[model samples]
Target: MNLDNILYWFNEVFSSLIFIYMLFVILVYSLMLVFAFLQLRKDRNLDKNLEGKVNLNAVYSKPVSIIVPAYNEEIGIISTVQSLLTLEYPQYEIVIVNDGSKDSTLQTVIDVFQMEPVFRTVQNQLPSAEIRGIYQSKLHYNIVLVDKENGGKADALNAGINVSRFPYFCSIDGDSILSTKSLLQVMKPIVSSNGKVIAAGGSVRIANGSEIEYGSVLKSVVPNNPIVVMQIIEYLRAFYMGRIGLSRFNLLLIISGAFSVFSKEYTIKVGGYNKNTIGEDMELVVRLHNYLLKNKIKKSIEFIPDPVCWTEAPDNLKDLKTQRRRWHQGLLSSLMLNRGMLLNPKYKQIGLISVPYFVFIELIGPIVELLGYIYVILSFVIGNIYLESALTLFVLFLIYSTVISMFSILLEAWSMGTYPRIRDSVKLLLYSLSEVFWFRPLMVVFRLQGFWYFIRGKNDWGSLTRSGLQKKTNDTL
Candidate 1:
């Protein structure tokens, strides 16, 4: 056969495969979007009715321990703690674990909260690194600070778990700020589920370019920065189309550590967070599922769409790439560690469905998508009928990003009303539609690098620079 003929046939097979794969992905996303919409429509009046009937201040409500793990978080730790102090829940204690920050994270927290060195016994219920000292806040009596050795985030969380004195604990990142009602809303499912829901998490919104005062989001505005705006779209897609749909049937595996609540009993039973992995939050959720499915226990982990955690997003491409790479790496590590559950009939939906979905779609998706982009570039060089195939594939990519992302943005607006301005929504709509051309390709490359890191046996908490959430800024969308 001629070389040109061989090239044509090879491109035919490869382009066909990309078409089929992209079609399957679009179908799945379509189904999830439908589920998400229905779920939101059903719970349309959830916040108002629940607020009217349920009193969060009553003793009948369960108290939660808010765990803030800090490592070089001097820039944002105090603000995070202050935000938690304003939680509208009936009772909760703030436990901040200072994971041996090289900076003044410990001292900054100490001086700000009027903390004094205190003798407090922290039970080693979960494995953790050694503790240097424990301090209690004099200004806020319920706040306890732990100075521990430099362990990664997962280890620091476990240390906080050991120190927490509540039946359930909420893990909030050092740079995260919660709305006053976030705790109440996130805990609503657990509080109402009659112990059936073991864990629950709320949505997270970018705090960049928003007005903040005293650790509270005084005004909500979309940032004009394209980098931060793209992240907002990504968050919307992940939470609205992904988790909310998965949680409808109890197959949800990943909930953000930045704003998730966990039952101490169940998390402890699963041996706490796995310090060996970069994605401890997801690993813990999957482990909880593994324990439940294997033991035939009837329980669920959930994602509540009502509450939102305001956290800072990296405002530059370099930092954004680092964060995305670390996230993708963590995802790969978690899935590989739990490969036993993949398509195993014994584990039912989690094994047969959720695990495989993440493995095939979420984990290796970037590689395939990268190949699709390559095929597009090569088709032009190879010309003729291949151009038709390339054009079709390009349109498919456009639909895959634009339709799904636009729906997510609309869902965010309909469900949360986060951005009141019409132009902000218009900006998000335009960017979501344009993502496949630029932002999506960049993510494809970055995530592939993350997959590479996982193969090389590298797991580390990547560094992220944070401006304190309370700092005033105006970058209008």
Candidate 2:
């Protein structure tokens, strides 16, 4: 065959595949719209129920042991611990695992809370480094600190989990601040459910440039930087729209590591967090479900949309890229680790539905879509295909992006009403629409790099420099 003929044939095949992929993208967006609508309805109902029902006195709840895995978190450790002490829950203890910080993390806690040595048993251990000493807060009866050798976040969590004595435990990041009623919100499902509720995850918001008073977010204010501001919108859309729908179907793949509450027994049963994968939060949840399936035990992993936890976002481009790259790597790790469950009939929706959906859309969708876009642009440049076809595809992409962003905002406004100001909501809407053209492609590049890094077998836990939550007068509000 002639070279021209070969190129023509190849182009034709590629164009067909691109068209099919575009169609698939359109279908996913359309389904997201439907899911968004359903979620908005639920959000409306939840809002009505949640408005007057945030009262923590509603019921007697089980005591919770909050586990915060801290590694060199000197900037915010004291404040984060202070905030936990103020939570509205009646019975709870705070356990902070200082994972061999080279900073004054241990000393600061010791000074602030008048720490004293305490003895405790690490009941179950999968794998972790040595413990230096366990300290209890002289000021707060419920607070305790474990000084441990350097390990990864998963290892730190395992240490905390092993030390916790409560029936339920919440694994939280050092930089995260939980809502006063978040535990109550997550615990409700566990209390009412017929069987054990193994895990429950709550929504997380960006805390950049917000007033933080003693570890709790005082108000919702958009960050000054465009990147951070856009992240705020992204979190809203993700938690409100994506997680809510998945949670409804009992097929949520990840519980946010920022604020995920788990039953102590089930977590221990699954060997705690898998220290191997960067996506420890998700891998543990999937392992729990797999264990349940294996043992023929009925369980649930619930997601509570009303319970909000505020966390800091990357302010600069470098940090943002690193965070996104790590996230992509974690997603890849999680999917690869659970490959056995993909389309396996026994696990039902989790195996046949959620796992495959994540594998295609979330994990690998960016690579496929990016290549498709490149092909369309090249075809236009070569003047081979009609310009109208490329233009139509571009329009379709815009429509998909705008629709999902708009739907997510609508769902949030109707459901949780977190972004109360019209201006803030409008800004989020605009950012979501703009994400497709800007943030998404950058994400694609970063995620690709992540995949490459993982393939290259680079497994170092990179240091994340903290600027601390944006300081303002309302820092303690």
Candidate 3:
């Protein structure tokens, strides 16, 4: 074939394949949206307020140990603990695992809570760094601190698990602020299941422009920053569209470390969190599944929708890029470590459905979409390609990126009143239009960078320079 004809044929074949793949992905995401809609619709009329005296103290039921692994979290550590203290769950103890903070994180919490030395012996069931000392708050009997050597977040969690006295332990991010009833809400499934459910995760909301007091989100307002607003929309879509749907069929592989409840027994049995992987939360979850299916355990992990774990989204592009890249890297690492389960009948739905979905849609989907974008650009500039093909792919990108996000905003409105104001919701809807053109492409590039980093064996848990949730938190406290 002539050079011109060769280029034409190549463009035709590539564009056609991309078009079909985009259609398939859209169909899949559409199904997830429907599943999410049904799930939310089913619980729409239920009296959530009357969840019935959720916090009844440690003696009444399965008391929980909330583990907050802090690494240089001086800015937000105090607020995080303060928020936990206000939790409606009455029977929970707060364990702040200070993972050798280089800053004043250890001293701040100690001085703030007037924590004194306490010689509480732990079984040390999990392998972790040596603990320097354990301290308990004089103000609150339930609050404890573990000062340990620097061993990353997973190791810190492992240390927390070893020291935790309860059957159920919650892993919460030190920089996050939990709603008063969030802990109770997240634990509802586990409590209701009576040991059938092993782990449960709550929805994480962005707290960028929200009103806050004493580590509690007093009011939920959408941030004015466009980037932060886009992240808010992304969170809405990811949790409502992806998580709710995946959890319905017991195919959930990831529960955010920001706020997730796990059975200490099951976690220990599966070898706790993998300290070596950046995606420790995901790796542990996949291992939990692998262990359960391989050993014929009947327990399941879940993602709960109502509980709100407010977290700070990276406001600027630089921090946001780092966060996204690291996230994608973690996702890839988890999938690779558990590659044996992929399409294997032994692991059942997790291997067959969840693994494939994450592999095809979550990981490889970005690269494919990136190619589609490139083709669309070249097709527009360089002649000989069909105009209709370019238009079709562009429309598909719009539907995939922008339309679903708008729907997620609608879902947020219908179910949870996180952003109740009409104007903020309208603003988010407006910004989502630009996602296909700008935001999504940027994410694809960043995520592609993550793939490169993963190949290079980059294991650093990159830090985000935080602008604390509440500027005057320490001074006020």
Candidate 4:
């Protein structure tokens, strides 16, 4: 056949595939709307029952060891630790693993927390390179610190796991801050599950420009920067809509690195986090499910909607691109590492459904989207104006993205009422519109770069220059 004939056939095939994928996308959004609505109702009912007595002290009375793996976080380590110490939880220990930072991270923490070096024996069996020393807080009996060699984030977490003296361990980013009650709320289902809950993940809010006092958020005014505001909306959609449906099906692939709790025994049993992978958080979660399925164990890994942890988001293009690239690499690493489970009947929903969906839609989504865009643009440039076909394609995409974003907004308004101000809601709405046109394309490009980079064996961990969370001290309010 001639080139023209081949081009015509390719266009026809691509058109059909795009339409089918768009349908699936629409259906996913539709189901998400239903799930978010249901979750919103459940949240409202729970809120009514715990009105005045909804403090972390009342709900989560269990002992928890909060593990913070820090590399070079000198700028915010003191503030983050101070915030953790002030959390209203009755029983919890703070473990900070200093992963061989050349900066003043260790000294800063030691000086701030009044640290005294303590002799603790922890077996470094997880293929970690080395450990320099371990320190315990002189001021707080519950706070411990480990200064280790330059192992990765996964390595640092494993080091923490080995030393943690609690049944449940909460993993949080060094730069993130948890609400006092976030631990209490996240621990409720774990403790109340009668030993059935294996893992629980919480929602993470952006703290780019929010007014954060000590460790608590006094008010959540939108950021002055457009990038930060867009991220705020993105988080809302991801947590409120995307996770609700995924959790209901027991096919959640990721629990945010900002805040997630896991039963220490189960986590240790799964051989800890995968050190070689960039997406260790997700890899661990998937591995948990894989273990449950493989060993015929009945356990629950859940997403708790109410518990909130706030973290800094990238406000500039360079930082945002680096973050997204790492995210994409992590996703691919998780999927590929667990590729054996794909379509394996033993893993059931995770294997047959979730894994395949993520592989198709998420891991490789950007490439497909970019190609589709190219094909459509070529068609428009060429005189082959399939007017009805183009219109259908555009409408389908617009409706799906808009509907998912809208449903997430509605869920936020109904469930937590976080975006209370009318202007914030309106900004989110404006953001939703901008997402399809502006943000989505940029994301696709960044993600495509990630995929290609990964394929080319470029897996270096890029450092994100933190803009830092907006401290209340800086705000006039």
Candidate 5:
């Protein structure tokens, strides 16, 4: 064949491959959506029935240790602690780990909670950075503070784990606020399952424009910023469609670090969190799965959609880009490190389905989608291409992106019943429709950069600025 004919054939084949990939993605996404919808419906009904029957003050409820790891979270630590103090769970203690912040993070906690330094021995099951001291709150007996040398989030969590007194320890971000019933709801599955559920994750909602009262979100408002709005939609789609479906099959690999309850014994046995990777949350969950499968333990990691943890989302483009890139990098790192589990029958569903989905659909999805975009442009420029078929595929992709996003938003509205204002729901729907045109492409570029950074051996956490949760009252918890 001549050069022109070969080039033409290459374009056609590439375009055909892209079309097939899009079709597969759409099919998988539709399946996930169906699974998610059924799960959400079931959970909603279960929650409704349990609300009247289940007693919050039941004697059998297990105590949890809430761990807040702070690096430079001076601005939001106090409010976060306040939110923790108000949890409706029967029993829990707050342990805030100060990871040697250059800012006055430790001092702020000490002053606010009237912490007194005390010499106490820790189990130190997990290896971590050096500990400076441990403190107990003079005002609140249940609260404890750990002063530790500079370590990343994972190290700080491990340090917290050493000091935690409860069997289950929950990791909460310093900039996050949990609803009053969040802990109770998240722990419900574990309690009901009789230790069959090893870990449970709660839904994380963006708190950019929401009105907060004493560290509790009083109203859930969709932020006016285009980026924040896009992220709000993204979170709904991920948690509702992606996580819920994955968790149903016992194939969930990631439970958000922002608010997740984990069994302390299992966490320590699995070597706590991996300090080396930025995606410690995901890495730890995957490790837990690996450990359970190896030992033939019949425990599960669950995602509880009703327990909401409000978190601050990056409003500016720079901060948002940094966050997305770092997240993608962490995801890539976790998958690479656990490559042994991929297609390994010993791990069952996680190896056969979850890992492959993450590798092909989650990890390389951005590259493929980006290539699809490039192919469309090239086909247009090169004229004698299959124009009609190309346009049809493009339309399918557009519908797959925007329509699925809209459905996710609607699912959130139907299931969670948050964003009560009809106007807010409409706004989210409109923003989700625009995702295919602008926000998705931008995220695609950011994720691609994250892959590049990983390949180039660049390790940067990037900048994350917090505006602090809005407080309606200055009341102390």
Candidate 6:
């Protein structure tokens, strides 16, 4: 065959493959939408029944040790600590791991909380960086701080784990603030499961434009920044549509590290967080799944939709890029490390459904989608595309992006009633509709950069500047 014929054949094959992949993705997403709707409805009804029925401070509830790993988080650490102090739970201790931040993060906590040095012995169950000293807050006897050498987040978490004294442990990022009842709500599934659920994650909301008073979100307002507004919609889609459905089937692969509770015994048995990977949260969760399948253990990891942890979202382009790249890198690291469980029969639904979904749909989906975009441009330039078919696919992709995102926002408004303001809801809907044209593509580029960085062996946790979430009047810290 001539060169023209060969080129034509290659283009045809590529177009066919892209179409098939797009169809597969759309079908899967549609199924997820159904599953998510059902799960959300069920959860809402259950919440109604359980309202005022169970006491969160009951004797049967297990005590939790809240571990916060702080590194260069002086801006928000005080607010985080204050929030933990006000948790509605009956019995819990707060362990803050100071990961040798160059700033005055440790000193600020020490001075504000009136912390005094103490010699507390740790069991050293997990390997971690050297500990310089440990301090207990004079104001709050249960609040402890571990000043440690400059270790990464994972190592810091391991140090916290070593110092923690409880059957269950909860990890929260230094810049995050949990709702007063977040701990109670997140622990509900674990308590109801009778210890069969080893880990549980709560929903994380964007706190960019929200009013914060001593770590609690006073009034949740949609940010005017288009980037932040888009992120709010993104969070809604991820938590309401993706996680809830995944958790319903006991196939949850990741519990967000921003706010998650784990069984101390099980985490220690699985060797704690992997210090080498940037995605320690995801890696640890996957490892837990692997260990359970290998040992034929009957336990689960869950995602609770009501428990809300408000976190700061990237508002600018540069910061957003860095965050997305790091997240994608972490995801790739987790999936690659657990590649053996991709289709293994012993792992059941996890290996068969979740692994394949992450590998094909989550990991490679970006590359395929990018290629499709390029193909569209080339086809239009060459004037060889079928207009009708192209238009249909384009509409489908738009629906996948805008419509689904809008649905998620609507679901949140209907069930959770997060954004009480009708204006905020309308603004969120408008931003979701525009996400496909700009924000989504930009994220794809950032994620692709992350993939490239991973391949080039670049290990850097990009800088993140936090505008501390504290009301001006309440900024005493």
Root-mean-square deviation of Cα positions for candidate 4 versus the true structure, in angstroms:
2.4
Clashing pairs in model 3? none
lDDT of 6 by residue, 1-477 (tens): 998888778877877788888888878877777888888788777754255247564524699999999999999999999989888888999999999999999999999999999988898999999999999999999999999998799999999999988899999999999988898888887887788999999999988888888878888888788888899999998899889888889888988999999999999999999998899999999999999999999999999898899998887999999998998898898898899999988899999999998889888877987887777666666665444445656676787788889989998998898889999999989888788788888888988987998898786878887888866322111
Candidate 6 vs. true structure, TM-score: 0.96
The segments of candidate 1 whose C-alpha lies over 4 angstroms from its true place after superposition are: 47-61
TM-score of each: 0.98, 0.93, 0.97, 0.94, 0.96, 0.96
TM-score-wise, the better of 4 and 6 is 6
> Which of candidates 1 and 4 is the stronger one according to lDDT?
1
The candidate scoring highest on TM-score is 1
Q: Which digits, one per residue and each the tens of the lDDT, describe model 5 over residues 1-477? A: 999899878877887888888888888888999999999888677655467247576514589999999988988898899888888777889999999999999999999999999877799799989999999999999899999999899999999999998999999999999988888888878887889999999999988888887777887888678888899889998999999989999989999999999999999899999988889999999999999999999999999898899998998889988999999999999999999999999899999999999998999999998987777766677666557656866787787789999999999999887799988999998887778778888999999988989999887877698778855422211
Per residue, candidate 4 scores C-alpha lDDT tens digits across 19-101 of 88878877876887788778768767765336425544444456899999999998777767777887767789899999999
Worst 10 residues of 3 by lDDT: 468-477
Q: What C-alpha lDDT values do all the predictions have?
A: 0.90, 0.79, 0.90, 0.81, 0.88, 0.87
**Candidate closer to the true structure by TM-score (higher is better), 2 or 3:** 3
Per model, state how many residue pairs clash.
Answer: 0, 5, 0, 0, 0, 0
Lowest lDDT sum, 10 consecutive residues, model 1, at 52-61
For every candidate, C-alpha RMSD to the true structure in Å: 1.3, 2.6, 2.5, 2.4, 2.8, 2.6
Candidate 4 global lDDT: 0.81
Q: Better model by lDDT, 2 or 6?
A: 6
What does candidate 1's lDDT look like per residue over 1-477, in tens digits? 999899889987988899999999999999999999999988885666467246564424578899999888998887788888887777889999999899999999999999999997788989999999999988898999999999889999999999998999999999999998888888877877777999999999999989988889988888889999999999999999999999999988899999999999999999999989998999999999999988899999999988889999999888888888999999988998999999999999999999999999998899999999998998888788899999999999988998889999999899778988888888899889779999999999889889788888877557877777868887874
